[model samples]
Target chain A: MTVSLEQARIIIAQTFKKGSELGLKPLSVVVLDAGGHVQAFEREDGAAPGRFAIAHGKAYGAVMLGMAGRAQMARAEAQAYFMSAVNGAFGGAVVPVPGGILLRDDQDAVIGAVGITGDTSDNDVLAGLAGIAAAGLKAEA
Target chain B: MTVSLEQARIIIAQTFKKGSELGLKPLSVVVLDAGGHVQAFEREDGAAPGRFAIAHGKAYGAVMLGMAGRAQMARAEAQAYFMSAVNGAFGGAVVPVPGGILLRDDQDAVIGAVGITGDTSDNDVLAGLAGIAAAGLKAEA
Candidate 1:
């Protein structure tokens, strides 16, 4: 019933390693357990300072809604009023955008999520998906 | 993987309802998506002034570690030297204790987490579990 922190750390480390292997810039990688809690997080050296929290925020937003943040961007654009209302409703917790991906088990249930920053939003999303896959989890397209 | 403001409000409401039904004191409930970012949070009317932030910090720590904050007490105790060195790691994010629980789906994937304050640790954990359950998610033991 518990998501092992050690495993999470290992997965995060692997994620960073993958990022390095890809010759990408330093990244902040974050992992969250199914309950939408942080399982393990690491901000690579030289990565932007605020990217850590921003990546976390983006990923958290995605997991809560069971969709990608980027998908919500269109909704936000069409419903600015509703989006603004969400900002007030969550006291500023909502941030529907990309750079995050949900982690799923073999059974296809969302078990956790990964988020990455310190690169383009597209890059972040790719990195997050790679990290989840490295951990032997799947990501919904 | 975003945690919408609406989801946050729903989680908080569930947490407060569980507390009131049990005749507990007013509580502050915080929901964080996977990646250790705040999603939605609320402190019941008449709750302690600082309980909101404190509960959030603790929940952030819990989710980041993918375990209950209470569970991290031992690690924190044994790794005092290291813990102190990173005392403000994650910008004061490590709550490493039992007052929170991770949110997981049917396959045991972590989607988010909830933390509760204004009651005993046992009560807080109970309230969090109730909130996760209310959301139709499973809580790690």
Candidate 2:
């Protein structure tokens, strides 16, 4: 079960739409396929200079962690040093933030993920999850 | 005219299809907009490791050079030191390979580029050019 390009477009579009509807800032959204390759990505005009990198990092990180979004946040917080090590190990590919979310297909298998940046972490999570739901997928958690 | 994600997908799909029809190996492909940002990318199952980097470098080099595909090879041959400096400056993002081609719109303006890896450079270029044509776009020269 791979994340299709159409689904990736929906994920990116709906992520920004939800962010705007919720008064979040312009966003950079990234969707990665199960293979960790970028399926589709977009950086809205006026998005922060480095938002795309942050967004991609978050999604890559979430997928590499093999768990849903921030379900491991508490664990990461308790082991900050280990988390730092993971970041170093991945070469900054993982952001370990709320905006990164693991997505599941109908079979409930981890297929890929959506990552958003340019807004507060909480709002970024809201938009990312909303976008996944809009695409008829579930956020693994 | 920017290369939309839909167009990028078409290019990638047709490139892989062409490669298969020619009995070539599995491949990794990348499409970058004029800004050198990834619009879409794919890595076929069983593609060799490091294919993605090579593919991306090819596309990045094509777009950055503002020429069509391997058309710059002749210029590079005349100025080996200059071309070597370019490759070093771009940190290997600029590959002087045949597999990268600049995409052009109806007005013959460059909009993006496609890069493919995993097969011979000649076969990769054939697939890349075919994919661009399949998307109803031109390969700028």
Candidate 3:
């Protein structure tokens, strides 16, 4: 399905609610279309200033590299040179980590991504995944 | 010369101040060292949601390609294919416009860049330039 701003917002809103329900610290969340254009975003109170970048970078990095950040971390070790070159080339915009995942529609096409920050990378990833699932979308991995 | 975090903060703060003084909307400012590491950044209230990505991409483009975004726009004329390839490859992170600039310390060596968004592209350029100047840094342009 097409990536709609409404859908993105719904997902993000639900994610924020879940975060609050869990009593996690404030979070910054973003959704991007398959084209990587931002679809929706929300910054909770007290979210760090740079949290937006961290979330975007993780999402963009995952999309660009076609894998989760954790997977990238594993690959980065053996492909250190390649990863470094790209990292250098992208100017810190590309941060490979597990807090991001591609969103797939029922048809299994990559529709978009959800990213969150303001906790451990693992917690961030879990939140992102929850948001995607709550949106009634599926994560391929 | 090292790019101090303080200088980066000053640059971002001034850029937002200048943008607001001119009646521009909230803005996001990015500072990148010559090696393209993030020195600092700030996002103003009501700033366009994704001003963050555009600012970073604009700055990254300037630093990596060794030309301002406007110059990249000009180069895009004869280099359309290359430009498209870049856009295709980077997914929307390659913003080739004039809103970003190279920064140099007194020694005149390219040290880093600053990118701003939340206004017209011209204003974006002006904001970045203002940040650089306010920080007492020079642009190689």
Candidate 4:
């Protein structure tokens, strides 16, 4: 099933809330449907202007490639040209970072993805996981 | 001055509310800072997958060009090549359409823009106007 608008909003809101609670920098979050289309997005007050696009690219890469962000990063390092070609094909939407997480349904099928920015990649991933858990969804990180 | 994150959220929320009240199709709304960076965006549950990009392009074009959607459309018709060049320059973030509006402060300085899509252009403009009014901001349409 596709992610509803309410679920996307919850994912964004909770992501920011988690970031705040953890004392991370202001965060930018994006939620993308399985088709790699944006469902919802927000950038906190002090986040840099480019954070939104970076978050979007990370989530788009995860949803479109059916891989977790960590895997994408590993592959990018092992096959730089391949990663570049993929990013070019997708109009540069693949960030290949650690902050993108796939959301799974009860059946273990990918339903959507969330990407977070404005902190270290590891910290970003933590916030994403917290948001996914709060939304009652499983995260494939 | 730039549009704050809270103001951007309010604009998107109220835009969707107005669309719902008018019985319009599920809409995609985007808010952009004056620098043409995304502040917030959302696509309603039933909105088309591409609606988010369309809404973003509309708002980006408005903020980048410092013009209302009507003015952009008129210019696009009068100078198609120029419009194409501008879109190319912005990496295709400029959409000449009726749903884009420039948000102005009390002194008539542009602070941001809002864009809506998924309904007829006229109805989209109406919803955007209503949202801007509700947000207590002036719309340069």
Top DockQ hit: 4
Q: Which one is best on lDDT? A: 4
Predicted candidate 1 versus true structure: per-residue lDDT over A51-111, tens digit per residue: 6567667767667767666776777888989867876865576566677677677677777
Tell me the tens digit of each residue's lDDT in model 2 across A11-115: 887987898899888877888877666766677655654565788888887788876557556658889888889889988677776888888877777788888
Per-candidate DockQ vs. reference:
0.03, 0.22, 0.05, 0.87
* lDDT for each residue of candidate 4 in A41-125, tens digit (9 for 90 to 100): 9999878989888998889899999998999999999999998999999988789989989999999899899989999999999
lDDT of 3 by residue, A1-141 (tens): 446655775677777777777778877776767766565555664565567678777777766666767777667787888877877877777777677777887777887777778887777766767777777888742
For model 3, what is the error of residue B83's alpha carbon versus the real structure, in angstroms, after optimal superposition?
1.8
TM-score order of candidates, best first? 4, 2, 3, 1
TM-score of chain B of each: 0.84, 0.93, 0.89, 0.96
The residue ranges of model 2 lying beyond 4 angstroms of the native Cα positions read A1-52, A67-86, A103-138, B72-82
Per-residue C-alpha lDDT of model 4 across residues B1-141, encoded as one tens digit per residue: 988888888888888898899999999989998788888999999888898889988888899999889999999999999999999999888889899999999999999999889999899999888888888999976
User: Which of the CAPRI classes, incorrect, acceptable, medium or high, describes model 3?
Assistant: incorrect
Ranking by lDDT: 4, 2, 3, 1
lDDT of each: 0.66, 0.78, 0.71, 0.90
Q: What tens digits encode model 2's per-residue C-alpha lDDT throughout B12-65?
A: 889988999999998778888877776666767666545767888888888888
Give the Å shift of residue B25 in candidate 2.
2.3
Position B134, candidate 3: lDDT: 85
What is candidate 3's CA lDDT for residue A63? 66
